[model samples]
Target: MSAVPESNWSAGRPDTGLTPEERAAEQHLELLDRVIGLEQQVAELQSTGLLGPSETIAVERNLAAMRSSMTWRAGRLVTLPIRAAKVVKRRILG
Candidate 1:
């Protein structure tokens, strides 16, 4: 039989070879850890109150920049179908 490529294994995974299910479980655990980290950051931010003046200004500038971008406008156009579907579902259900 041909040898399996070493590159298929991720360095972050255990040195012991993992079945496909074990690899997926490891990836899921890693993602959960990252999400927990982000939640802690958001909680810290909430306790500190809203953004500072400079942060607010920076956010506004970034939003203005995105609004003027052609690619951003195209992305909104691309999502129109998904948005319309949600609206249609709400109307039919209500």
Candidate 2:
């Protein structure tokens, strides 16, 4: 049989040669752009003063709940792979 080439093995993961810091900076810039957009929205809402005190309170509560939910979901997402690995290892060994 013919030998498989090393280039063929790595073909599935082509390298763009970007450093980790460069990738992180790119992601940071994208997140900053989203933050700027959210800031603009908050400013617009403040200038309009469309929400009364009770409505504002309700909105703030909802925003806090959403933030908490997002944080929880993010933590779960980060741990999911480790959890799956543990389950697989337990099934294999136990």
Candidate 3:
């Protein structure tokens, strides 16, 4: 029998020559790792609790990340003013 093409796999899994059950287990492990990573990232962001410019910097970093993404970039126009204000504030405060 012909091996399944890469795209036909569920979850867009690559053809790693593993059996279906093994692939399922591997995907589960991968998903678990991603969840752990996301949790760690959230913890990191939350731990940066600060006030004033430092807090604004943190928010700007998050916004920058969102702006870099294809899907979220749709909202970039809405946030342009906030970014402009930050630029002006930074110049004035510095």
Best by TM-score: 1
What is the clash count for each candidate, in the order shown?
A: 0, 0, 0
RMSD of 3: 16.1
- Give one digit per residue, the lDDT tens place, for model 2 in 1-40: 2332323222466675556687677667766877888898
Ranking by TM-score: 1, 3, 2
lDDT head-to-head 1 vs 3, winner: 1
Candidate that scores best on lDDT: 1
In order, the Cα lDDT scores of the candidates are 0.82, 0.76, 0.75
TM per candidate comes to 0.47, 0.37, 0.38
Pairs that collide in candidate 1 are none
- As a TM-score, model 3 comes out at 0.38
With a 3 Å backbone cut-off (N, CA, C), the pairs that clash in candidate 3 are none
lDDT value, residue 33 of candidate 2: 72
lDDT of model 1 at position 58: 100
Rate residue 59 of model 3 by lDDT.
Answer: 91
